[model samples]
Target: MSRTTRPRKGAAHGDSRPAQAARPSPPTAETVTPDGPRYLYGIVRDTAPLDVGRIGLGIVPAQVYAVSEAGLAALVSVAPGRVVDPTRAHLLGHQRVTETLLREHTVIPVAFGTVMASEAQVRALLRTAQGELSGVLDALEGKVELGLKVLWHREHLAQRLVLEDAQLLRRDDEPEAEHERRLEAAVEDRAGRDMRALLEGLRPRAAAMREHPPVGERMLLNAAFLVERPRLEPFEEKVRSLAARSDTYTFRFTGPWAPYSFVDVHLGLRDEDASLP
Candidate 1:
């Protein structure tokens, strides 16, 4: 008895008109540019061969490009986009480029995550920073940086300290927790003081030494020494003697790196200032 309207084809029961076709969404930033020139990393050097080929960092290609200055070079590659997210591939690529170059030549390695808008910018950096660049090159020439990590076997050293601190050890006879705590504290303090004195005694024999905070169960002393190539053997021998004399600690030496910690271009001005008459 009630009037009924005819249903429209290709439309929902409640729709007033035919439904429109679904359209594809616009492309995302990730999908837009899948491949392009990526400013990967750089190195400072007097000269690098143009023909050096295909040094691979993972699956990516490693290529070397020179900067505008006569004594600088930038190692770069074509990345998958302008965005490089510092993945393992990227970081290792940076290390590989610098390490490979250092094997044959002296290099002032830039820290990882260096990027440029274009190759021209890379060249301009070389041209503008020429003085600073030259200083880094000169500082690193004919010398190598060695890393020495001195670690104390804490259990051994602690036991020895306990023996040495007889008064503190005797206090352990008291049942009071507070006295036990104080004794432990005194033992640790004496151990730290003795270790520092030992490290200080070894400094003069080294070109430079730096002590780092203790890590984990071992006390770590991280040192970087600039040793002349010929003197490397004697330098190492000194380290071994120090280790052999002490049963409390062991030394782990890793070396001949690109002087990453020691090469400070700013330090070069000190030399220039002294030379001025």
Candidate 2:
């Protein structure tokens, strides 16, 4: 490969060399340009003007803003590379912006670190997903999602379940030592029945529900519910009722937030410079 030298501003026509040493390069894999890609936050209705402030990820100070095409609007900011680093600062920054949008508008939360090469590509995405995006915005209107994670105090809940259900008694075929060693598993066998009952009890209150795999050992249930604004109070009451029934459990509940789990549109674009390889 050959490198070409372009003259600096105000330099003579034939004088192209710099008066100083060349700048060192960034560590490998970093995008080395000011204009690499734009990070997407989410899609919002474009009917009203947005007052999003300057707060998005990048080495440069970026102003949060909107770009629209074919009746779709995306909230985006300048990105320093093809993908933003998944560090805590970047991830939390993305979340805080989405949290801010929930206060005033219906947002179709894009996955964190979503990036497009330029404003043109952002417009192209809007055009490609236009009809689907519009329909999602409509369906998600006046609706939000709530997340619930229920965890059992592993030892206490297992003991409680075993005490309540005679069927959970250690089997005659099972070794006494083994049953004593893994009493928690014996407890969970019965607890699964109660958990199923809890699921059935909560299903009627949600417009839609998505269950996630538990992340850790003590976690029993991880789920999100898409709920209408009008039913928000009823949903809260139901959650409280469920919580009341579980004396040996813990619940971490959040939201009344943007319908993040409910939106079906996917922009699975991995790279803007598709020709790079």
Candidate 3:
């Protein structure tokens, strides 16, 4: 799923990195600005301080780096304001940061537009949530998220079903509309069964699976799988086999992505003062 290398054994979960002592000292008042809020990307366990790159959102893209506390680190950048707008560029920047980290670490992605007042607030968050954060990090270690979608040409499948099944054939005595309703029901049943079979084939390869509502009538399955790094190739192979087995349905596959759907922690921050749309 990812061409990026994995961390050394025990590194992804946690290491013996000294906590706040290893982190860079906070800027003195004379050199620091008054209202420079921190825009958080995500968190990883027990890593030494790192500079991710210049991929943050703003008038001028800011440099992203880690702030450590209690053996955990948050990837953050100095934001232009307290309220970072969720514009296309900004959202992509946020996603890029997380995806970049996912290449080497199991990221606990924070909510989009999460901004704290200063390094103190960010470190405070890591310090306060250390136990909960560490537990989630352990569960997600060495895994990545992948997405799948299946869609079909409804009219084509319906016609084929009618031709193949005697029960599905239109009767001269049956009204055209009534026959159409029966065809719709048959398509729904068939799609459901097919979706189940697809999931069953790959379920054993995943640590966790999430189902999203299909977007259109033609779409039958929309799902995400949390797969271990070692199992990635096999998981992808299973998907390919399933797609090849069905010519009637169109399959779309994506990702070696950050585990956006898997992390369940809430930061419980209040943003009442911001003018976020």
Candidate 4:
């Protein structure tokens, strides 16, 4: 599987790869100190003091290790600074840590650039949110997220519609706004029908599905599916079947990575809850 960049704030974006990092709500406060601030990567179920490697964010990459408490572990590295910029290097570093954990455990990904005051704060967050975190982890066990984007040849379809349907033809006395509205309605109707059919075909293979807005006019469907690890090949095969049967649509399939699209737990700190994006 190809490596993926971390999802950005507000919108979750991933390539045709298996490693899109989650976009959790960033912590509002960060202290840039020499011996404080730990960058959090994700939460897992192991309680052992596990160290992955020296593949973390920094000018000199920090060592990523697990901070365990109450049958849970938070994958973390000491921050180079408290407030990390969303640089390409930093995002990929964050992704690398999560992707590594994904190979062995069910990870609940924390948002990119998340920092706690110290290791104690990290432990505190884990101890406090243990129930919610474990519940989400149980729900996502052995599951991987897959993304599919279907784009149709709109101009080609429009030409076919003009020849095959009377409604697609320009009416003699229709106003421009009315004509535009009718055309848009037609597009939506057609896209909706096509998307629904595609969803129905693949829904059985997925435990859950989330749909995102199409990026452009030619894009008909942009969605993510949560599939079991053992059924990945079957899911890919199904996607291939659908794509093979379509002449006007092109399918972009990616992932068997961390369940970024499905995880929704937040790490709460002290007085108020710090939201994850």
Candidate 5:
């Protein structure tokens, strides 16, 4: 038997890969102190002070703020001297702050738990990356990224394909003699055909898109679309319409989120420009 498995969502695409903008590493629990490290959320254009109230990582509450330089800002909060855990609460807290900015601004989101030793280090990073960061922000202005994942049920898809083209299977009733490799191959072929039909329905509404490799065998499509603000409704409506049009495949749709897949930000272990302790 040829069995298939799915990895945890967002895990197959490891985040340690190089990205575009340089950022501070997450603070270490042993070396951090309350009021010392600033936890980074994302980078934004100059904006009014934000006050969402006490959603920071760690045990105590932290005030989120922006360290701005040359019209760019790094949204951050004081940390309570601990390494931020990848707990549900912390991840949601990271996303909540970024989503808040998305309502009125285009931002370059940082990974969860990112931290700077001090606000001054964050300011220096903003100053150093100003030119490149501004260009990216300009490109992303008035746009947001939407995530779409398609998971296909092999048996259901094979059945649908058999109907669409009865010749898809040589013998419909010979289940006992079926070869495992052949069955898996057949499923893979049907998935490609379905992917084409889905993309034809989505690409027109997106300004740009990034396709991540599918996570597992059942995943037919895993992608992020960068869409203009004006086209968001049309894009979302199209997804709904497509969902209504199918049962063989399931659609997982999300966001108006920061363009994480599309943004090119890479801060390394020793990003010389990121020197602010």
Candidate 6:
């Protein structure tokens, strides 16, 4: 014990040899390479279907591919490397694929800009999130999203305002003066107030409503409603009545979307979770 032990040869004097680095996991076929394109996004489906020729994206030929897992399938395309950024064209393409499928089969639309390493990864995602995916698909089945936009013809409303406001209409007979100008302003103010009341009255009937900010001297009210297929006709009839009653506002309806605005697939995640993959 007193003799002690000799200094450890390799470990002595604070050996300056660099530490061994941890080896990274081997890359799989689906692993994204430095120059490889992103996988983008994944959709939910029970099984992948057979390849059905190439779909055309303008002049570019886009091949449709599918990945299945846990009774869910994802339809994918090869995105061009040059246009990796999510542009209008890319988003529209994503929507087009889902929309086309919805015409015949039920589909749960994936959020835009989803990419995976390979079909395997997509399958893995589906397997892990099977419950959520199933729920989403079930909810979206037999339902479509519709968009309605209400725009006011300001000139018409203003004219009606002047005609309806006795105080302002009487000003036209009086000599051009400050009182007439004040009267005109009051009439315009009253017209705006009345229009707002009408819009507010219609809010309850709408599933969701958003008033577009006044842009470049124009006013717009945009809304999206998730109406069942059978209810569409009645909804349109209500809209027609609203339009007839308010000639000042023009109603434009576009619909049968893939529930893009209503689908909430991130239910299981925590409040701070930002997992889009």
| Winning model by TM-score | 3
Q: For all the candidates, what are their Cα RMSDs to the real structure?
A: 23.0, 15.7, 4.0, 8.6, 9.4, 20.5
Per-residue accuracy of model 5 over 27-92 as CA lDDT, tens digit each? 434224444777888887664444455555544445566565666667777754436778776777
Which scores higher on lDDT, 2 or 6? Answer: 2
Clashes of 3: 0
**Which portions of model 4 show Cα errors greater than 4 Å?**
1-35, 47-49, 166-184, 271-273
List the lowest-lDDT window of 10 residues for candidate 4.
11-20
**Candidate 1 per-residue C-alpha lDDT over 1-277 given as tens digits, one digit per residue, 9 for 90 to 100:** 1111211222211111222232221233321444335353445553424334455344555554443344556555544455556778767776667656555555666555545555445555655566666666566565566676666655676577667766556454577787657666865776668667756656665566555555666645666677555556676677676677776667777766656676544322221111100
Q: Which order, best to worst by lDDT?
A: 3, 4, 5, 2, 1, 6
TM-scores, in order shown? 0.68, 0.76, 0.87, 0.80, 0.77, 0.64
Off by over 4 Å in 2: 1-36, 58-61, 165-174, 178-186, 268-277
Q: Tell me how candidate 6 scores on lDDT.
A: 0.53
**What is the C-alpha RMSD, rounded to one decimal, of candidate 5?**
9.4
Worst 10 residues of 3 by lDDT: 268-277
User: For residues 96-140, could you state the per-residue lDDT of candidate 3 as single tens digits?
Assistant: 898778766778887788788887778778777788888888888
Candidate 1 ranges beyond 4 A from true positions: 1-42, 47-51, 80-83, 172-179, 211-217, 263-277
User: Which candidate number would show the highest lDDT if scored against the true structure?
Assistant: 3
Between prediction 3 and prediction 5, which has the larger lDDT? 3
Candidate 2 lDDT over residue span 61-113, tens digit each = 35677776656567777676786788876776676677667666667888776
Instruction: Judge candidate 1 against the unseen true structure and give its global Cα lDDT, from 0 to 1.
Output: 0.54
Per-residue C-alpha lDDT of model 6 across residues 1-277, encoded as one tens digit per residue? 0111221222211111222222222233323334333343335443324342344122453555555555655665554642445666666666567656655545566666555544444555666677777777666555556666666665676577677865556555566787657665875676567556656655555555444454444446555666555555666666666677766766676766656666666623232122332
Provide backbone clash counts, one per model. Answer: 0, 0, 0, 6, 7, 10
Output the lDDT of residue 213, model 2: 96
- Which tens-of-lDDT digit does each residue in 1-277 have in candidate 4? 2224423323222111221232222222232224477888988876333558788886556678777666677788888676889987888899788777777677788889888877777777877887887788778877778898888876676666667788877799998889777776786677688889999999999999998888986778889999877777788888888888767678888876677778776665755345454
Rank by TM-score, descending?
3, 4, 5, 2, 1, 6
Which 10-residue window of candidate 5 scores lowest in summed lDDT? 1-10
Give stretches of model 3 more than 4 Å off.
1-22, 25-31, 269-277
Query: What is the Cα-based TM-score of model 3?
Result: 0.87
lDDT for 38 (candidate 5): 75
lDDT at 122, model 4: 78
